[model samples]
Target: MASEEIQIKTDYITLGQFLKLTNVVESGGMVKLFLSEYPVFVNDSQDQRRGKKLYPGDSISIPEVGTYTVTRENA
Candidate 1:
């Protein structure tokens, strides 16, 4: 079966910023809380850090929400 892909463009974003950009969390504190309770998958692996830095070409998956492909936009 074919997989669905969602692309996001940004320069350099931390895990917290990514969550905000994706409308996953409203604030940093909320991001932290969600990270601690929910399983965030990075490149198909479980990532449990809210401070993890994310760059271009990084893929993140959240259960039920699907996957997102990160792409850096030129400055």
Candidate 2:
């Protein structure tokens, strides 16, 4: 699977926001429905919470989608 990097200026971001940022879903409202249909993995562990806090080093994997790595860049 291809790996993608998502840069964030803040300390953390929510899974729902991340999904939208990555274009995995069209909007935040679709996050919940999307999660229920697909398995989302945080560092290889399944996570279904749209509010889950994702740190800079956190890695997200969606089998139907692709792998994403959270990265923090100084602004």
Best by TM-score: 2
lDDT of 2: 0.95
Task: Give the alpha carbon lDDT tens digit for every residue of 1-75 in model 1.
Answer: 223443446555787888887888988779878888889998788988877877777788888766787775655
In candidate 1, which residue pairs clash?
none
Off by over 4 Å in 2: none
How many clashes in each candidate?
0, 0
Residue range 1-75, candidate 2, lDDT tens digits:
878999999999999999999999998889999999999999999999999999999999999689999999878
Question: Over all chains combined, what TM-score does candidate 1 have?
Answer: 0.79
lDDT of each: 0.76, 0.95
**CA lDDT, candidate 2, residue 65:** 82
What is the Cα-based lDDT of residue 41 in candidate 1?
92
Backbone clash pairs for candidate 2 read none
